[model samples]
Structure formats: C-alpha cells, structure tokens
Target: MQKTEKPFVEVNNLYKVYDGFSSVLDNVSLEIARGEIACIFGPNGCGKTTLLKIIAGIDKDYQGKVLIGGKSPIEVRTGIVPQDYDMTLLPWRNTVDNITLPLEVNGYSRRVLREIVVEFLKKMGIKLPLLSPVYKLSGGQKQLTVIARTLINKPEFLVMDEPFASLDSSHFFQIADVLKRIWNLTEVSTVLVTHDLVTAVLLSDQIFLFSPKPGRIVHCEKISLPEPRSVSDPLFVETVNYLQGVFLMGGE
Candidate 1:
C-alpha cells in the first residue's frame, strides 16, 4: 500500500468560545506543509492571535484539532515570538544572556550557552549589541533579540505574532530582510500573524485570510514570487494591491 502523506501542521474545525458566549473562531481549517512560511492576515478581532496561541500550546480552552507533525502542539518543539517584545524580554538581561536563557532552563552553563548563541548568530548572520541590556536597545534591536532568543533553541515549528508591528519603516525592512535570511538558513516552518498585506506577500509561501469575529479561513493565497523579493518589483506591488483590494471588498 502506498503511504498517505500528512501535512506538517493541521487545524481542523477549530472553534473558540469565551464564557460559552463569545465566538472567536468558527470552523477554521487549514494545512501547512513542512518548511513553508505561512502568514495569517485578517482584520482585528478576527482571532488571529487566538489561533496562534492555540498552535503554541498557550491556550487550551478552544475546541478543535490542531496538530504539528501529527502530534499535539505541546508535543512538538515549538518557538513563539509574541508581538510585545518589550514586555516579553528580560529587561535586566543583555543580548547574549537573553538569547541563552532558554538553554539555561535546561541546565546549560552560561559559558556554554553563550558559545551556542555566538555560533547561532554566526550561522544566521545576525549581529547584536551583545553587552547592552535589552531595555537599553532600540525597538528594532529588541525585536531582533526576542526573535534570536526564540530561535536559539532550534524549534521545529515557529509561531510569530505580528513580529514587525513595533518597527518603523527602516527597521521594518531591516528586520524583514533578516527574516528572509533566517528562512534561507533554517527553513523552519513558520506561521506568522500580521495585518500588513505587503508583509504577507513578501514573507509567506501561503497567505491565510481570516474573516471578522467568528473567524474562518476565507481564502488561502499562494505566493509564487521568487525569493529575495523587492517591493519595487511590479509583480510584488501588484500582489499587494490585489490583497488590499480583497480587504477593501470585505474578502469578496
């Protein structure tokens, strides 16, 4: 018998209700292939973060099946980067210390973990102010530190919620380029939540559009643009405009 292939990540009939009244997500289903970067784009209150929380094993009240590599989210090696970089990062910890924090949890010595962080930064081509405390870093630098900390453990599935939400245009593109570099280096399957159509077009292999509250998968767009994409490219602009039109038309 031929083997049946399964998706790397699967969400089937997902429904989330708060206090048995508020319906956040309804009958949401989607499949993500291994090593692909998928973006979740939707209006505010459409349960994008709820879905991400469910996938990250942070929220367990929802009713539905969410699987990562045919196992529950808790069973997988998952890394999560929340939108609030400032709140999540340790203000007292410097860049290397913060990046090594996860390893420290597993009883790794600080010296060893610092070596690992150094190697990881080298591999990812990332340079940070290693001695500066996270609170002293700029917004972009803080976000990059959070990302580096999450990625240091080499997670099998990565979940990022609006990673670029806090950056200005210059830092936004800088971080976006870093993300592309990370994808090239690790190819870690990622589910990123973002409100920006341009970001979705630039980073995702598949873009999942959700409806307003009681969110469902309204559309799943495949982005076939070549890697190292540029906003100046005509096709890239066209794709962003098209997605914007869809949003303006209320996902019609």
Candidate 2:
C-alpha cells in the first residue's frame, strides 16, 4: 500500500518464544490493506500459526504490536477458522444447531435463527441434513459447517490456519472454490496461512512468504494475475512457478 494508505491489519517487529527457549517468530512485520486477501505460506513449524495466534489474541505471550483496524485484535471483530474445523464442531449438536449457536445465544428466537441460517446456507449453496449430528457428516461437510458457524456472526475479518490441510486434492479445490466465493461476495479482509503454494497463488491478492523456523518475512509480493484462476492458465502457471522459486530461495 502507498504511504498515505493505512493498513487494516498490521504486525510490527514481532518476536515470540515458547517455553522460554528459542524464538518462534523473530522480527516479523507485515501488513494487510483493507479488503485484501493475503496468504502466509511456509514449511511446517515455521511459526505460521504462531504468528496468527498472536494476531488473533489467542496467544498474547509475545512481544509485538498486532493491530487490526487501528485496535488490538481483542478490540476488533475477527473470526478464526483453524485446520481442525471438524474437531471444532459440536459432536452432539446437529449441523444447523451447531452453526447457529452464536445466534441462539444472542437470543434470536429459534424460528428466526433457523430462517437466518437457512438463508445463509442457501447463499453459499451448502446443503446439509439440518438435523444430522456433526459426527455423521463427511469431512468436507464438517468443514463447511465450521465455515457457516464462523460466518454466522459476520466478522469483518477472518484468520484461517491451513483450513484445507485435511482434505485430499479434489476436496482441496472444492473448498478453495467455496473460500474464493465467500471472499469475493463479502469482500472481507482475510489472512490465510497455508503450505500449498498452488492454493496461495490461486487465492491471494498478495503473499507474505516466510523463512523456516524462527520465521520472518523474506518476500512480500503482489500477485498480479486476474481472478477466476485456472491451473491451465499460463499466467497462473507462471505465477505459481515464480512463487515456487521464491519459496525455494527462502528455504536456502
């Protein structure tokens, strides 16, 4: 972003250490412009999720400044979708009930909450057995249910940690499409952490590439390819290849 344009989410000079040993994230700094979709891609244990935890207010035992829309994450409206979305669902609660828990607690009449949830699901084209217990649903369905639950509150921003990690290649693309759909429709600023370079290339407006453990930003580049990206598209392939090189260099 330009000097005059302020970021909606900003992290500056972050440092994190676990068990008072070595650093997890060292001197990490990055920014996300409002409504931009940025991806943080790196190898496992590179402090990707650790960085997100700090930004989400889930882990404050760190040294850094994490600001969301000029306020700390605790002071702003944000939702997190972890990789273990299936585990996050209420096993005893049926699909609809689990997704609507937030609304239910807010005192929306049962009838009203049901109507609202149905409408939201319809918009997303997600059709699941309303009364089916979450454990009975398929993996993809569970992920969808988690996304629905997260969206029910209509967060201004979203932080996703390898949300598609559990899926196979086919499911990966399927969920990736679902994510892109919501992203374009809602225009919500999102920070997605993923290990898949292809997924990042296809989805990100820009990418914040990290080095190995004790992670730090090694490359932050704007993805100039147009959307509705296809694997066969030359620009898409070129961009992916370019990012592959970036990642390779970062690991060296």
Which has the greatest lDDT? Answer: 1
Whole-model alpha-carbon lDDT for candidate 2:
0.87
TM accuracy, model 1: 0.96
Clash numbers, per candidate: 0, 0
| Whole-model Cα lDDT of every candidate shown, in order | 0.90, 0.87
TM per candidate comes to: 0.96, 0.95
Residue-level lDDT for 212 in candidate 1: 88
- Residues 38-103 of candidate 2 have per-residue lDDT tens digits of 999998999999988888778878888889999888876777888897668888889999989877
Off by over 4 Å in 1: 1-4
Candidate RMSDs in Å, in order, are 1.9, 1.5
Worst 10 residues of 2 by lDDT: 243-252
In candidate 1, how many clashes are counted? 0
Q: Which pairs of residues clash in candidate 1, taking residues 3 or more apart in a chain or in different chains?
A: none
